[model samples]
Target: MTVHEDVGAFSPDSEWPQDATEWLMLLREEPDDAEIRARFEVWRSASPDHPRDWEEITHTMGVLRRVTPVVEVPVGRQVRRRSVIQRIGLGRGRVGLAAFSLAASVVLLAFLGPDIALRLRADSVTGRQEVRTIVLVDGSQIVLAPQSAIASRFENGRREVRLLKGEALFTVRHDAAHPFTVFARGLTVTDVGTVFDVDAQDAGRVTVAVREGQVSLGGIVSEHSPILLGAGEELSARDGTTETRTVASTEVGTWAQGKLVVHDWSVSAVVARLSPYAPGPIMVYGKTLAAECVTGIYTLTDPQGALRTLADGQNARVVHATPWLTILHR
Candidate 1:
């Protein structure tokens, strides 16, 4: 009997059965086979929760089999196997197999939904206060800002990037045969051999700023015309409304150089942008103080000093409640 020890890592407290589903699927396909049953017994005893999850899954499958009837499929008839699994009930072993298939699908979906699946699929991620640059297979470069995540794929004459969170600046390599496209926050930005910055923050808020060349921006939610942008162009989109304007091309992606240039941006917005660079949380107590706008180029090398400069300029009070907490009040 051969035992496969190469099964991936498993956490006892994980919400879903990790590698156990593989064992279950194998058993379901060959229930009467003794080898798989023996291997499953070995795997089930490896951890305490493994047996508990297996028993619960078995109970669920039994309940499903009791309620669902199997339909007969004609021999030599064309039918989708996945659809057939839900409709057909053979003998005891086949019924258990079908039940297991249905239960496994539900378990996997509940455990690894869209967000977790994306995080798992991401090719690279940047932590807080960390910036990373990745050179793609096609010679394109992407600089990921703090706390950003991205997945890239180049196949079938197309280059694609899915930005999961935070910001990224793309310096695309011109490939006429394979156009580069970026997906983020229900929006798509297709590169036209240009350098552009994409900021995908919380609540479906996204900002795309062009530093060179041109690109097309469109919403994934509705059928809308693509907004074209050139050098020094900027577009901000939130909820459903989108606004486009002009910015200094040289100052567009200055954060990559350890500087942040803001032109008359509100204090809250400034704090929000700086929070990613700060070691801890920056909270604004008063709405009026947060709404006050300031314009300047701040050095990210000293986040606390930048905060102090903003506070002193606006006559606002900076309270250091804790080493990790900075509060601003008017």
Candidate 2:
């Protein structure tokens, strides 16, 4: 039997668990690299504990594979992966280079149930540090931010897209005969021949910002009398409350261009926006530190510098520069 099926055959020594896990992730990332395989053979023979540690990871992955194997992010375009969570803890941990959440997949899967379910329903997904532009059959364009997913349904002469996770900017093509609508959370943004950005990243909030033209927001707020937003206007809906504010239209969806624009956003929120582009996890500790507000345009290409600058402004600091993690504390 294969290594995965014989988990009982090997009693894991746990001596080189971390090393073995890292090696497994690396190998999966470069399975065809003969050099890496050769080096792995050398390391495997270095100690007997190594074999058991490696076997333990195989068992874990095998279990996960059997339980929830593939995630098909396919419709009519190209996708990066079709299995496991791309970033965060597992799938591509150590900041997208290795895996760290496999051992804790069961616990994480519990917490990530909703997101995993969303991924299963998604038609397009952008992994960590990936930004993708999809052109539909109607010539409309969709720019998905990092760690984002969307599912589109174009039937009955109407186009509807659901923002599964993260964020996306839609540039709709004018179709008077057909309507284009985007759904997120409990809000529906119906395009009025316009370009708009929908963000569902903030906790319990789906933000709609119009870059050009107008869009009516229905659902949660009555489809009969949908709220209308013009160019340069933005709306945020959360719980039962809705808030509207005006921002420069040019600044909307700048994250797709490697710049993050935030206004009066909490320090914790700003860091959350930066985490997808970062090489490691960015942790903001303490409620007091998390509550402070920040407003400015930060460079996403240099996430480290941006976080440091943001922290400096709040009299806070970012510690622990581990390649896979960053900690922010007062």
Candidate 3:
């Protein structure tokens, strides 16, 4: 099943070789074909462009196979080969060879279409303290925050995403067979089609917040207690205990826009939130100091300033345990 054989599948009058599918089938069943191997060399030498297109077809097939399970060959609506020997219709008089060449080109293009689409659709990485907004081919929007990395692959079975680090906000487009899933650390967040936020913390914690739809969060998250959260709801996991809490966080996604608003929270909790953005370590001197409650809006633009403000306003002192470490005490 070579590109020459499948001319009709891609374009009815295209002279493209239908050999791509055959090579794919052969590679899957019996990859070490001596004849195919020999033919590959000769084919490459035939024309510099021929080998390039051949590689493109093969690459396209591989991507398609990984993303979609079913591979089909169409018989009736076929692509016809064009005049291969014809140089921009120069060899039109030598019709047969030109037609064969044209057909090969069309079939090759068809096979390569899927691969090109995949490349255009995939989203890769977001570095430290940075943000990336991706518009997927399916029209979904994904905003990945700093230090986050995400990879997406869409196949017949599902649309999968692996989050290597940090956080992401997914505004998914609806596709049941291609359900969107974000994998991070030991957790997996699966969504049909919704807007949600996923955070992968360094301390073996994963948090999922649903802004406009529903999501099933599992793994180191809730574990056996897989929870579904809707708009304005969030779930957090730590040590093995999972907690689901509701907040009046109408602006739950302010961090994506460079603002982090913390409501009534303990000093320890506030310190924990500030740690990631802080230039140095932040520690509360004693258990009582750490447990002290903090209520204010801290600007993330200048985290060190916020620390100084905390010390001055709370009648607390900032102690330098070490150059890289600092603790707060009364």
Clashing residue pair totals per candidate (backbone < 3 A): 1, 0, 46
lDDT for each residue of candidate 3 in 98-173, tens digit (9 for 90 to 100):
2222223233332332243433443665433346788877778888765456777776666778776677788898
| Candidate 2 C-alpha lDDT tens digits along 37-101 | 65566567667877876776577568765664433222221111212113322421232323333
Residue pairs with colliding backbones in model 1 are 70-89
Q: Could you tell me which residue pairs clash in candidate 2?
A: none
TM-score of 1: 0.62
lDDT of 1 by residue, 208-291 (tens): 999999998876533577788999999888878878888999988898878989999999988887766766556665557789
Model 1 ranges with Cα > 4 A deviation: 1-118, 221-225
Q: What TM-score against the true fold does each predicted structure earn?
A: 0.62, 0.65, 0.52
Single out the weakest 10-residue window by summed lDDT for candidate 1: 87-96
